[model samples]
Target: MKSLSLHFISIGGSVMHNLAIALQQQGHKVTGSDDEIYEPSRTRLQKQGLLPAEMGWNPANIHTGLDAVILGMHARKDNPELLKAQELGLAVYSYPEFIYEQSKHKQRVVIAGSHGKTTITSILLHVLNYHKRNFDYLVGAQIEGFDTMVKLTADAPLLIAEGDEYGASPLDTRPKFLFFQPHIALISGIAWDHVNIYPTYDSYVHQFELLADSLPKAGAIVFDDTDDMLDVIALKEREDVTRQPYDVHSYRISNGQTWLKTKSAGDVPVQIFGEHNMKNIAGALAVCDRLGITEEMFYEAIQSFKGAARRLELVTSNDQKTIYRDFAHAPSKVGATTAAVRQQFPNRKLIACVELHTFSSLNKNFLGQYRDKLDQADVAVVFYSPHTLEMKRMEPISPQEIITAFDRPDLQIFTDTASLQTFLESQSTAAPSVYLLMSSGTFGGLDVNRLGEQ
Candidate 1:
């Protein structure tokens, strides 16, 4: 690889910002432009001396000196910088395409599914880093050990990526994972998501099948045994690919710590809890095993994993009250997160509040999938911003619809953020209680940490 000058369009996104920093660290001159840059990204990019001096796209930033232009999904087709790059005949590529190019000579391990992809990818990166393995990775969420979520090195032999099912770029309709052409893949589980795009459950599931089928004959697939849908698809559709299925590993939580029981590794204590996380551990173990990591090493590394950001992340906790925030908006995610919180604090009264912010979660046809997902909570609350519905061009949904969709008669529905805030404030913090806030959005700009403090 040669030292090059690279410019990124819409570089403030989670993955894009990390890639910029990674390239900068690799001795590349990196420049980027975005219409807006938010808190952590702004601070991080500024710290790395990569932050754009201005906010919006500036055509002056796009010049002939650029080696290649990396395009993020955030940039619109008519973006000024993108158009200028095209006019100058500069080589332009989507983020995924660039990642694939970088890892073309390396072993690509893509973790794909409708949910839990981030968790699985994070675990793999954590374990690999524990053993001091030299590898590059692109995970959706922030991990503790790694300085950035994206890493690229000239000599790394492996590249781990979270294979999102959403469209890759404005010019590309295909899912991002399709381009990676992984040597090893893992499908955590499949459920209908991005209803605005896939339209139907079958259509949503076909994307995973396509990804599985795209693998080379020598490629490996580690699938979740808990997902019968994925199991059937793997058995029926993939003949050339080697298949490995993993379920929830043996685990027990005692005195607020999670312990895993494995045949070769024996008892291992972990910082993270949840059956879903245990299943993620199994999938990570399978991937590491394929990559030549011994069972003992894998267990030793995974036991210290603290989990990905905002996936049941504990925001604030005292003896009397504990609050967690999770990026769980899809039906399957909602169920898994709520269950995890309930299991971890069985003695506490669990108040699970989910915000229906995503296209699928707000879709009238897909709402039924959430039925009984919040049943485990002692009290369930569903929140949705009317402004979000308007922004998505969706019809207004009634509180009755949400209540009925969830199939919980005790469920409360709130359309106002202030009202929801008031309700949370009214809760008793004198006794030990768990407040599980689940959403892909920011709950109408509510300061969750502040609420947790109250």
Candidate 2:
């Protein structure tokens, strides 16, 4: 691939901005536009010299010299720049579709599911990089050792991707994962999500079904055995397609540390713990094995992986108390993360605080999905902002409905972060306690690090 001129519409998104920076690194002239750009993305883009001179679409930005116009989901079909691109008869590609186009000649590994996509993808990338292998990748979250979330090169023969189930573009209703057509795919687990799009559980599950069916007959699909829905789909092979199902790796928790019980490598201790993560590690190893990474190498390489950012990320810690924040808004993720923290530190009193930030979690009908999800925590609180409801154009939910849905009569709920922060600071001061804050959105832009400090 030669250096080409590229234009991006609505490129200030986390993923879109990273891709823009990556393309510039590949020697492409990258330019992008967005209505508004926020922290991290804005700073990163400015650093890469890829930030748009002005925020907001401009038809003038689209021109004949551009090799391609990558569309971000934020851009509507009627975007002026997009319209100009079409009028100029220039190539237009959705983000994932463009990724597929760029890496079509390479061996692509797409890790997909409702959860664990980032962790699994990161695990694979860490192992591959540790072995000094050259591979491009597109992971959803920031990893400990990686500089950019997206990487593309002419020489790398393999590309690892975190395949999101979200829609590709505003004009493209199909899930983003549909475009990859990976030579290898991993379905972590299926939970009903994106109710606004899928509506029914079956409909949500069907997308993974389609992704599974899309693989080449000679390709492979690795999945976790713990999820019944995923097991049924993954275990059923498609003629030449290899189906591999993995369960939680043998392990035990002791003194707040998780050790993988390996046969030849001895006990391998890891930075991350929990049944979900164990399964994720197993699934990642399964894919690595298929790619010629030995079990010994997998264990050796994985020991150093702290975690992807914000996926149960440790904010601060000490013997008296520890704080962690996770991007867990869905019911399944909330339950899994809360359970992991409690199980890891059985002696500690767990204070699990999760904000009902995502549309699915905020929806009144979806509230019941969280019933008893946080029961394992010694103390738990659900926080959602009334202003958030207004911004999302959603109905205001009363505290009684939330309490009733959670099936915990005494469940604490908050509509404001100030009160939530005050309550948390007081409770978390107790010794031998863990404060696990979970959300897809910040608790009203609350600074979690400040809250975590003693």
Candidate 3:
């Protein structure tokens, strides 16, 4: 592969920055601009010598010499840099489009869904890496053994990617996964999310249907059969394409430890628990089977898989108590995680706290979706910031609306972090318990380490 000259717009984004670094490491000339770059992305770019000297877009950064300009979803369609690229007739591609351009020659496997995509992709990557297979990947989170989230190599014959249903970029309104054109795809499950983009539930589900229809002759789609919507999609008439369905893997929890039951292997002890994870394992196994990995190999490799970052991650643990932090803000994720934790520790009291941070979770119209989602927890708490609503230009929501939406009269709601913390401290006086802090954002900058202290 010859070195290519490429520029990125809105390079500070989580995946955008990682893609830029991946290309640079592949011996490509990479330049990018963004108005604001946060931690991790900022430091990572700096270490790679790719950080823009000045923040904000400058049309001067655009040049005819560039082979292609990759646009991130964070950038606006009217961005000056994007306009300049268009004026110059330079090829502009969304990050997803660019990823497809690079991996067009390789066999593609895309893991997609409203939830569990990251975990399923991470599992596939971990198993492939364990067998020393030569493959490239683009995962959403930072895994333990993988240094970067995106990797594109010239010689690798396989490319594993996590497909998101969100808009591809400001220039493209189509879902990101539509661009991958996977020879093999996995839809973990479908639950309505990103209400701001797909206002109607049917519209949100249509994206996955498009993916299923895009499969080529002899292509395969691995899906969760338990999901009614996914089951309907799989039933679509596609005689040429194979539909592989999977359910939750069998497992048993003993003395607070979850063990996976394998037919070949007597029992496989895994670090991660939860029925959702078991379902993730089943889906991953289905995909791996198509990739030529045996069930025995999968069990051996998966036993050591801790889990993707922020998915039921253990923050701190002791003989009597445990605290876990999860990136679960969506209704389906919140419910599944709450139930998983409660089931794992039936003898211990469970205190589950969730922060409403995403556009979907904060939307009044979408609030009803969360009804009974946290009912499994022994004590449930909800928190939201009014300042966030102001920033999003959304109408302020009252605590009563939330109470009515969740239909949990005993639910504790907090608008202030201090009060939430105080309430949390109050619960500590009770018997030995498990604490689950669920959110995609910080609980108003609450210190997890401090809260975890016994």
Candidate 4:
């Protein structure tokens, strides 16, 4: 591929910024403008010599000399640079569309779902890397061995993408996964999420249905057969399309370690715990199978997989106390993470603390979907900032409403970080208890290491 001059409209975004850097690293002339760029991204862009001179969008930045204007989801349709690009007749592509353009000739593997996409994608990347298979990939979260979150190369025959359910760009209302046009597609499991985009549960589910239906007739789909909706979709697959349904692999947890019962390898020990993760491993294996990787090779590689960041990551641990922090804000994720910890350490007293920060979690109607999600925890507590609700412009949810939503009569609620942190600091870690902190956002900048120490 020739060196292309690409400009990103909102390069401050987590995925968008990484893509910009990846393109620059691949010898493309990358330039970007964002209203604001936050930490890590700011430092990274500066380090790469790709950071814009000024913050706000400039229509002046648009010129016919540019190869493409890559639009981020954060930029609105009426953004000035976008309008100028249209006037100048320069190609305007959403980030995902541009990704498709770059990898059009390559065989695409897209791992998609409402939850667990990142973890499953990371698992496949790790396994493939372990085996020394050369492949390009776009993963959501940072993994241990990966240098960049996004990578594109000229010679790789395959491109693996962590397909998000969110909108690709302001101009594109469809889910990001639809743009991948995957030859090998995997939908881990679907649950109602992104309430702002798909307001109703049925509407949210319809997106995944469309994603499955969008595949080519000759393509293959690997799905979790355990989900009723995904199961129905699998049954409806076209006659020519290959459908492989996967369930949780048989596994047993003992002495705080989870092991997979593999056919060829026998009992394979794993670094990541949880029955849900076993399902993730199964789905990843199916995709790997389609890519010519045998189950035996995959099992050998996956034994070293610890997990992706924030998917039940072990923060700190001691002889009697253990601390885990997970990105489990949605109802399904919350239930899975909390339950996994409890199952892993059944004898330990579990104190689960979850922070409600996402739009769905803070919404009135969506709150009730979380009923009994944290039932496994010995002490269940929920924390949501009143300021977060105000920032989101959502209706202020009362304590009683939250308590009723989960149907936990003894549920404790906190509105601020100080109170929550103070309460946690005051707790006794002397006995065998697991302190599980689950959230997609930082719990008001609460330090996990410091809190775990007490």
lDDT of 4 by residue, 274-374 (tens): 88898998889889998889988998999888888888888988887889989899999999999899899999989999999999899999899999999
lDDT of each: 0.89, 0.90, 0.93, 0.90
* lDDT for residue 351 in candidate 4, whole number 0-100: 92
Alpha-carbon runs more than 4 Å astray in model 3: none
- Residue 47, candidate 4: C-alpha displacement in angstroms: 1.4
> Would you give me the overall lDDT of model 1?
0.89
Provide C-alpha RMSD values for all models, in order.
1.6, 1.0, 1.0, 1.1
lDDT of 2 at 32: 89
What TM-score does prediction 4 earn?
0.98
For model 3 the TM-score comes to: 0.98
TM-score on alpha carbons, each prediction: 0.96, 0.98, 0.98, 0.98
Which is the better candidate, 2 or 4, if ranked by lDDT?
Answer: 2
* Per-candidate clash tally: 0, 0, 0, 0
Model 1 scores a TM of 0.96
Candidate 2 residue lDDT tens string, 131-195:
99999999999997789999988889999999988999987879999898898999999999988
In Å, residue 261's CA in model 4 sits off its true spot by 0.9
